[model samples]
Target: MIEIVEKGVTNLELSKHLIKRLNYTQWKRINRFEFAQIF
Candidate 1:
C-alpha cells in the first residue's frame, strides 16, 4: 500500500509526508501486535 501510494503520488512533498506517516504507523501497529502476542 505504501509503495503504491508513493508511486501514485505525483507531488514530491506529499509523497515524502505520506511515506513517513505510513512507515511510522505500520511500525507502531506491528510493534503493538507483537507485544500483545508476547503476553
Candidate 2:
C-alpha cells in the first residue's frame, strides 16, 4: 500500500513536468512581442 502511494506520487510529478515542458515549448514557438499584444 505504501509503495503504491509512492508510485502514484511519482507518476503525478512526472506528468506535471511533462505538461510544463510542453507548454513552454508551445510558448516559445510564438512571437513573444506579439503574444502579449494580442492577448
Which candidate number maximizes lDDT? 2
Judged by TM-score, which candidate is best?
A: 2
Candidate 2 — which residues are off by over 4 angstroms? 1-22
* lDDT, candidate 1, at 7: 72
Q: TM-score for each prediction?
A: 0.30, 0.34
The C-alpha lDDT values of all candidates are 0.54, 0.56
Q: How well is each residue in 1-39 modelled by candidate 2, as lDDT tens digits?
A: 355446665644544554576777775685646654542
Please list the Cα RMSD from the true structure of every candidate, rounded to 1 decimal place.
Answer: 10.1, 11.0
Candidate 1, clashing residue pairs? none
Tens-digit lDDT track for model 1 on 1-39?
A: 466555765444544554587777664665545544543
List clashing residue pairs in candidate 2: none
By summed lDDT, the worst window of 10 consecutive residues in model 1 runs over 30-39
Candidate 1: stretches off by over 4 Å = 1-10, 24-39
lDDT of 1: 0.54
